[model samples]
Target: MRKNSIKNTRVNVEVQHELANLIREGIKDPRIHPMTSVTAVEVAPDLKTCRAYISVMGNEEAKNNTIVGLKSAEGYIRRQLAKNINLRNTPEIRFILDESIEYGVAMSKLIDEVTGKEEVQEDGENNQ
Candidate 1:
């Protein structure tokens, strides 16, 4: 088992993919929003702990609600995965709010603002 990169780690990748699919298709929790996505799942090589980073496409309150929903269903999720996946022990599941989406959205907005300002200035100079 080479702990090189995410691609090489089959256990981690497979488990994450299976779990994400399970949550997306199987679980029916009302608190979970429709646009929730599993951004990434990181599991220890020993299959001890699994951290699932999720992103909700909405405001802060919506994100918080989604996290709460996931936390409530964590046990059920783990149990289901254990029954489904062939493993000696199912890794513990921890749901975490992924901030990369938020960061990227903010960065893009900043870039757009700067570019818009530049365009306006260029047009003004041309007209003068």
Candidate 2:
């Protein structure tokens, strides 16, 4: 199958949904933060491997610990995926720490600061 086939897209979405559920409810590890979420899932066309991007809403320590916990529980997660989805081969999940969300938030804050300063300067010029 092609890399960007319709079937592949469906598989990616299904895997992402299942992974989010598994991480949120199936795993009992304390290191996995409650605010953790599956940001994206990319399944190989051959279905031999998968990359699961995870986002954690916490400190650096929490993000690191969450990735470690997920990596340790990969086997169980793969087994669960096999049982839940009728895929030809259960992909080996590689947990990836995604900082895109945090980066976006930081960028937003910077924009606001810049805009705020511009507005203040405009007001000062008008007053002068």
Candidate 3:
């Protein structure tokens, strides 16, 4: 079996990083919550549209508010992105809540709890 390289994935990652930084330092939307971070960017093969995944580290209200804020400023963001990225056509912006990072943290906690169980004395030899 051959190990495949994730060239496209790497490209997407780079784009995500740049986009995240751009959003953090460039746009200052009043609706945007203070704790928002761009988590991922999914660009289509044609690169016509890019889904920007955002993560907000706050309560449900804060999360919803941040997304609403971003949605309202889509046009401004698209323009800013166009100024930054050189492309034939600027990709349409779509803001999506990325819960994967939050989910991963939760999963890690659960896994730790489960693995800690293994340290307990089940029988005696099994504990070792």
Candidate 4:
């Protein structure tokens, strides 16, 4: 099957959703932060491998620990995945730390700072 085919897209979405659910409620590892989220999932067309992008809302240590926890739980996650979703072959999950959400938040803060400074300047000028 083609990588971007409809079937592949559906598989990706389903895997992503199930992964998020599993991480949020199935796992009991303390290393995995409660603020963790599955940002995206990419399953190979052959359904032999998968990349799960995970985002954690905390320090570097928390992110690292979350990945480690997820990696250790791969087998269990896969089994759960197979039971939950009827796929031809349950993909082997590779946990990847995704910093896009953090980056976006930082960028937003910078923008707000810049805009706030401009607003302050405008207000000061108006008061003169």
What would you estimate as the lDDT of candidate 1?
0.84
Q: If the candidates were sorted by their TM-score against the true structure, best first, what order would they fall in?
A: 2, 4, 1, 3
| lDDT tens readout by residue for model 4, 98-128 | 9998899999999999999999999999999
**Alpha-carbon lDDT, every model:** 0.84, 0.96, 0.77, 0.95
How far residue 50's Cα lies from its native spot in candidate 4, in Å, is: 0.6
lDDT of 1 by residue, 1-128 (tens): 55546543776778778877876887898888888888888887667888889989988888998899889988888888888888777899888999898899899999999999999999999999
- Summed backbone clashes in each candidate are 0, 0, 0, 0
Residue pairs in candidate 1 whose N, alpha carbon or C atoms collide under 3 angstroms: none
TM-score versus the correct structure, for each prediction: 0.86, 0.96, 0.77, 0.93
Residue-by-residue lDDT tens digits, candidate 3, 1-111: 433248546546756776777668776876677778987787765668888889998889888988898888788777877777666677787889988888999999999
For model 2, name the residue pairs that clash: none
- Per-residue CA lDDT of candidate 2, range 1-128, in tens? 44488999999999999999999899999989999999999999999999999999999999999999999999999999999999999999999999999999999999999999999999999999
State the TM-score for model 4.
0.93
Angstrom error of the Cα, residue 74, model 3: value is 0.8
Lowest summed lDDT over 10 consecutive residues: which window, candidate 3? 1-10
Q: For model 3, name the residue pairs that clash.
A: none
Please name the candidate that would achieve the greatest TM-score relative to the true structure. Answer: 2
Let me know the TM-score candidate 2 reaches against the reference structure.
0.96
